[model samples]
Target chain A: MNKSIIELKDIKRNFKVGNEIVHALRGVSFTVREGEFVTIMGTSGSGKSTLLNILGCLDTPTSGEYLLDGVPVRAMGKNERARLRNHKIGFVFQSYNLLAKTTAVENVELPLMYNSRISASERKGRAVNALTAVGLGDRLMHKSNQMSGGQMQRVAIARALVNDPAVILADEATGNLDTRTSFEILVLFQKLHAEGRTIIFVTHNPEIAQYSSRNIVLRDGQIKEDKVNEHILSAAGALAALPVPAED
Target chain B: MNGTNLFKIALRALNNNKTRAFLTMLGIIIGVASVITMLAIGQGSKKSIQAQIAEMGSNMIMIHPGADMRGGVRQDPSAMQTLKLEDYYNIRDEGKYISAISPSVNSSGQLIYGSHNAPSTIYGVSQDYLTIRQLSVEDGDMFTDQDIQTSAKVCIVGKTVVDNLFPGGGDPVGKVIRFNSIPFRITGVLKSKGYNSMGMDQDDVILAPYTTIMKRILAITYLQGINCSAITEDMTDQAIEDITSILRRNHKLKEDADDDFTIRSQQELSSMMNSTTDLMTILLACIAGISLVVGGIGIMNIMYVSVTERTREIGLRMSVGARGIDILSQFLIEAILISVTGGVIGVILGVGASFAVKYIAHWPIFIQGWSVMLSFIVCTVTGIFFGWYPAKKAAALDPIEAIRYE
Candidate 1:
């Protein structure tokens, strides 16, 4: 029997602008089992980001229910929701929202600061470990200003993983990167998935969704399709296919 | 949130905006400094005045006769010879609270000692006059009781009189001085006591036995006024009462009548001056306190700006598990830190200002420990009170909306 880690039932979000009411999300129902790598694809204003925010515990559904690890999240208090977000959910934004003045290691340690169980030294160690997992171990001290767009995204990924969260929520994590950098970050996501971490990635690009084990397409605030991808790309396979760089 | 962690975060934020934080604290600094400095000046002036009064003799009391109306004309009672030697003797004998008493008679004339002559006052007083007025002999001895009994022509000259009548440094003691051509031997010289508050030269007079002036010079049996000393400051009222009763009996005044003389005690003057200075001090402090309120408002303005600027950070913190109370406490701590730091600096500045006033302006300044502590506490409270709203605004932000804020 597969244990479902996240479940959404007929979730809807309505926004009132002046005199008009806009439905941002409507009758969206979905479920993901443990350790599943799922990607939701959609165009701009397609409600994919809203769905990601709701899944990340950053926002509550206006109607219906959201369950994380079989626990009702919609009815939780603010502190409870924050605790849930800190312990089980981590988010990576499209803009790579790493604090501007902080280094990669410090950015990664941000999530651990919210978790009191970890000592400062241990938090640093775990942050260094997360940065190493994202292949930025040598650039731990480099701030976001000193890093490229791809590197900054990797730092954000490291921050999302540093807490050892149950699920990683990435909202267009590679939307700002070039095609080559996008492939690299997708490979990193695949690597993280291989390590038994569940990930829900939101993207507008179909080529990026090909790296995930499963894909869900959203359109007009509703789920259009959900399917398993037989041709999902593995990180090691993708890396092997890339041409090796010559030592300068 | 743990206090240490909150403090660390507060310190970091303050450090991040050092100049802005300092400017926000400037109001508190100036307010506290001014309060402390003004209180010091006020207290110092009060203390100095008290000291001057005490030096003039804390136990001293002056008596002035009431006005006497004669034949539908208001006359100066002092000129009417209302105060008498018998009344002085009655007060001295009947007043238990009085330590000493002396009757006085004053006349201005040229005092001559061997062709060197100068204009000065001649005061006829009893033996207790020197002690009552806190005067001491610099040379020889005071007039003897024999001088009073026989109405002898002998006197004690003050320092300025001696300097003028005997300018060549000869011994004026035991030497005869001519006052209006009346030969009087100088028996002693009084030590210098600078000018009194009324601009009278305290050490520029010659003192003779009261009987000498009454029988020989003025040919009067009454006194111009009486000077007395109470045993202690607290006994002044009792002494006044006793002297008033004795004088009323001596003067044969009827019951239910006002006393014919007014008694003024040094203690009353001291307290009156002190209260006036205290009121002035409080007024100055109130004026300075207005600046503290303005400073608090400045802090509120800056804190409000800071909260608005860090809305995204607030959202991030809330999303990461910080409660509203946690955010509120953090901001409050930051404000308090600014105020407390400013207060400390202000205290130093106040002390420096006091010293500056003392040395440069030649004014008395007394910095008290309590004033510093009080100002510091007021500053910290101002910071907390003023920053509370901004902190609450920051705390009350919705995490979801804040995180998504552009």
Candidate 2:
């Protein structure tokens, strides 16, 4: 019964390649409601990146009626789209694209810096809160290169959450981590979702869909299947089940 | 984003690569420093030359017999006897702009006192010659008008002549010095003036009444030249015009005929020297300015490299909600900070170098306030002009491609 946070009707994206047109996305339809954890799954060349770009407001559909938080995005200008991206959506990349040599809190404060309404003190407070929420309070002062991959990913998540966007768009947020760290990050995501935050997790790995409330699988630029999971798995339980590695 | 935040961002980026930033600024530093130093030296020399001219009587004018074709052969002005004592008297009586006037004739010969002798020129002139030439008697007295009226053998000796004719450093006054076998009693000694920039020894001269040279030594009725002083430096032209008319009237020259005399003023010499110095100043500044432009290119080069190196960072910032203008201003601000900071340091170094040159090289140096201000404005403009393309390149980058750049 929650309001739709994202709506897409027959979205299509075409690319021109050396005198030929390539259809990247063909007539896709989907809606993500508030507080839903939706996992988008596809193989390589399955148009998941193009779909992610569209969902993140980085790229527009060639033809579609797309709405983000009830605002029609088809007619928006580039700058307006950038503003929309800043105010409504937060992005987390697979590589954890944090500024080099910057501290964790500073990385988290990056998103809020663009918002003129947020004062410096308020930005710092919000960044602190976000880092604490992601369980990185003790690591707030650690530089990006100083932290482990999982910790860096946590900082990226904190950055995403700092703006309090309507939806957090994550592109393989845990792809670079080891099994235990990936599960740990997944547990953090589930925790955030339980707190009523909307998230759209884009991944090529099918195993990640079991942890989310809904799944949309794509193949060759078209939707192969779309389903709501009957039961969501607990990432913390999965982490506990793995055998612990011996310390060096 | 606000300018302060952008400035901080720019500062932080520069801080990350301190060595590269400082190296890039070195070009501007050398450029600005050399510019200031060269200008100071140029201006300093020009001022010193003007002071020397002023000291020699700024309002002084000289009239010499003109070169003319006599019997189908061009004759030297010094060889011509066109300037006469009658012309001198006429200008003295009728010229309104003249403050002082004197007829001049000289006899170059060996001067001797006992066993000492030196080759020098004895200038025969009225007492007004001393005032017109800015000469002051350091000791004894100047000759009286009675000496000229009677054509008495009295003369003043300059320092060099005194030194040569009285090598014992004894007083030359009341001593008799023989000029070309003609003996004359010394009435005064001129104060010493050392060698000028042109290496001319001003102190090596003798002065006596023109009538003494014309009637007693040279045995001629025509005068060689006339020296006059205008009422003021600004009245030199009017004085020359007045003297020219009087001389023409005395000579009874036709209306369209050229004069048999040439008139020259210290103002004209001063202007000629000034033009020469100004040309040198401009040439030095132009050479210095080339290095500044090269320095600006250095800034552009580094900015381009910086933009390329931070492509991913730019993408991340754009991803985080920074607009294109924000990215542009950030890089532009960084370039500006580098140039302006270097400019300030250059100003300090330049001033220090000017003083160093003055003390160490013994060269005159004068620092103008306008040079410093000019460097500041030039460096700022250089930052904007050179930094623009690179910053624009950074701003116009596609966020997706930039983020994924290897």
Candidate 3:
């Protein structure tokens, strides 16, 4: 049995919105083992965003125990949490948040700047490898604004993987892409998952959830379903079966 | 993150938007330039005045006859002639730290030599007047003691007088020049000293013996003023004290009675001019310093806008393991870089402007090293001081909210 990299026990989050207590997340418990590709599915009001924040260590749960790689992260200070995020986790946002006008390789090198042990040469090598892993080796000097949305997303993935973290937390990783580009990104995710990297993907679309090894559904601030995916789909096979646009 | 990396990031960000960075630096550049240039002008004028006064002699002192306090009005010192030749001789023989002494009297008259004529002041002074007043003769010789004893009508002409009375460039030495219808033989031609700080032509006078002026020209027994030099510049006060005591004893004034002479020293002239120039320098600096404050505010304004505009960028950096202090330092470094770069350019421009004023505008300008260093330090401080609030606001931002900011 694989050891769990992320374990959440009885997590609760509350927000005071104009004098009324809105329960964003209520007693949500889940464990993500190492090397598993898990998809968290929910609607806009389902508290999945709150849960993702807690998992990414960007926010602390009001009442819960969060063990990230067996270290208690919820009790850590601000600086300690930053350290944990640098070494233990990586983030992929839907907006492909690469600095505009910055080259691809330099964008990939951003996270390693916060890592002290890595030398400049080592950081460059790691950045090149991460970008190559996402099939952007030839576009090393391409600026994000100068590249397509799909290419920009790949650069963001390279940034997330540069630190070789224990977990990758992606929120709507392919939400901004078209059908074909989304499938291509999902294929890249499958490849990273095959390389034994733990990924927690959050999406509102059920179609994206079919690619994960495990599927989680949240409703009314609680988990409605936490089950293994019985019929795992291949994003690459899906991409290949679709008809290419004539303009492309 | 380390400072090097943080600075590199800031430099890169600035390099990306070259125009915006330069525009921001313009304020500091103008501010520093104005401050240095103004100070240079004031300093240069002060130095020139000091030099002119030193030419008059730093260790020298003058004794002028006391003013006539008549009832409710006081007449000028030149109208009174209470000093006598006996008092001048007594101070010369008995005063300590005395190096040179001369009795001086003056009268203005139209000078005529051959066909050329000029109106000039004829100064009555002894042979010691040349060395005590730092005067040198370009031709012939100064009047002698025998001429003073015999009351001879011999005069030494200055450069302006020579140029005016002998326009043909002929030697005026050994020639007779008529002063108020009296023929006086010219003994020497003084060197040209040019214009003084007050714009007065310094070389527009003639020197004669005091005995000739008192016995022959004006026929007066009293003296106008006594000019004396101290052995050294530092001993001028003691020299003045000694001269005052000797003159009071020789004149036989009562214990509580005031002396009938007033004293003037070269130091007084220098210090009075120094204070005036110092006031001008401070006023100029204060006015220019206002622009510096405005420049600092410009940096603050831009940095604040930068923090607001780069909210998502801040979020991304925070998520990638950058601490609050790290974000703060990055923004702070950006501000410092702008101001410091501006300061350097401002110094270059200010020094250039000083030279330009000195050469092109014909204005005196001295650029002190301390002024440049002071403005440079001010620019750096302005960068950090004004950058603090914006950087703090950026550092205190919530990472989650910042990432979500549009």
Candidate 4:
């Protein structure tokens, strides 16, 4: 019923391999409303990654229109597109993509650096608040290499949430995490989604897709199935089951 | 794109690779040091020459015959064939500022005293020539006007000729020495003067009265040259003008015609030598400056490689909303830091090296403030010019591709 936050109409993307053109995406169309928790499912080479890149404004589609809110993405210049990517979209990669030498708080503060409107001290304060929200309050000063896989992912999530972007586009965010850690990340995503944030998760794992409200399966360069799932896990329910720590 | 952030990032990046950064700065260091040291040496020599020339009497001027001959033909006036003794007297009488005037006649020949014989120059001059040249007798009396009028065979012997002829013996004054088979009594022993700035031996000549040299030693001679002095240094130009007018009137030369002879003052010679040496020093410094440019190119090459190596980092920054100008500013700041740091170090080393050359090697060295500032400016410019293209390439990188780059 609400206006679509993202709209892609007959989008296509192609890659050149030597002299031959490889179609990464072919005439795909989709729309995501605000506060929607969606998952795109596909095996390797299914163009799910390419779709995520376009959604994040990191790359342009070869043809067709991609409109974020209302502005046509393909028509934006390099700097304008970068601004869009910085302020409108947040990305989570498979490897966490945390700067190795930087602290968790600094990693989250990166997006705020590009926003000239925010003062440096204010940006740092916001970054700290984002880290606290991700349950990384105690580990804000810890570096990526010092933290565990799950903690690093939380930091990456905090980084995604720092700029208060309209949407978070994640590509196989838990690909390197263990089963237990992946579940923990999924629980965090659910909590973020419940807080009125739009999330798009791209992964091949069926278990990961079960956490989202909607699922889209891609085969080769086209979508094979698009459906809504009513049985999505709730972060509050999951958190209530975990053991609570005693007050210091 | 703010300056503070850019500088912080650049400094951090350079700090990350300490060894590579230092090595990159080495080129500028060597270039600046070489330029400064070479220029110092050249300037030092020039200053030393000027000082030596200043020590020679400032008012002294030399007039050589046929000096204005353009090609190979003589350009003297018809009547100028005789630069007579009477003409010298007339010029002395006419010029107000004229302190002394001497006609010089010289020939190179072997001088013998007992078994020791040394080849040397014989100069025939009046008593005024000694005062003009700032030469004084050490032990015996000098030639006087009476000596010139009487055509006496008295002479002044230089230290070198004395050492060669009279080894460790007594003073050679009053001793008779044969100069080219002509016997002359030694009247005075000139005080020791090592050499002129041009490396000419000033202490290896014989001096005698001009009339005696003209009539007795080198017979049938007009005049080889004339040496004159002004009462004061400031009056040198006026004295030269007065002498020129007197000579022109005596020679009956028209105003349009060029003078037959050349008059050179010691001050003029000093200045000319100074400028020549200054030019030579600057030229050497410029050649050395080329090395700094080469060093800058080295920095550029390394920066390009660094950009390629850190493509992923560039992409990460771009994704975080860093503008191309921010990236450019960061890399450029890095380059300038390296060059400026190297320049500061190079200036220290250059000045130190110059002092080392001066004290240890005993060579004259002069280092100017302008040279140091110039080297610093050169170093900074080199960094920016050399680092521009690589920084531009880094800024232009595609975020998606760069992030994905293995």
Say which prediction, candidate 1 or candidate 3, comes out ahead on lDDT: 3
Instruction: State the lDDT of candidate 1 residue by residue for A1-248, as single tens digits.
Output: 56899999999999889999999999999899988899999998889878887897878989989999888999888778888888888888787877656678877877777666778799899999999999998999997789999999999899888888878989788989976687788888888888889999998888777789999999999999999989876655766777776679
| 1 or 2, greater by TM-score | 2
Give lDDT tens digits, candidate 1, residues B156-260.
988888778777897888898899989999899999988875477888888999998888888888888889999998889888888888888877899987677
What is the DockQ for all candidates, taken in turn? 0.48, 0.57, 0.76, 0.38
After aligning candidate 3 to the native by TM-score, how far in Å is the CA of A77 from where it should be? 2.2
Candidate 1 accuracy as TM-score? 0.90
**Can you give the TM-score per candidate against the true fold?**
0.90, 0.95, 0.97, 0.82
Clashing pairs in 4: none
Clashing pairs in 2: none
Question: What is the full ranking by DockQ, best candidate first?
Answer: 3, 2, 1, 4
Q: What is the lDDT of residue B368 in candidate 2?
A: 97
Which candidate ranks first by DockQ, i.e. highest?
3
TM-score of chain B of 4: 0.86
* Alpha-carbon interface RMSD for all candidates, in angstroms: 2.0, 1.4, 0.9, 1.9
TM-score of chain B taken alone, every candidate? 0.92, 0.96, 0.96, 0.86
Docking class of 2: medium
RMSD of 4: 5.1
Off by more than 4 A, model 1: A99-107, A112-125, A135-152, A176-184, A234-248, B69-74, B110-119, B152-178, B183-186, B195-202
User: Per-residue lDDT for B85-202 in model 3, tens only?
Assistant: 9989888888889899999998988998877788999989988888788999989998899999998999998899988988888888999999999999999989989988778898
Deviation in Å, model 2, residue A181 alpha carbon? 2.6
Assign candidate 3 its CAPRI class: medium
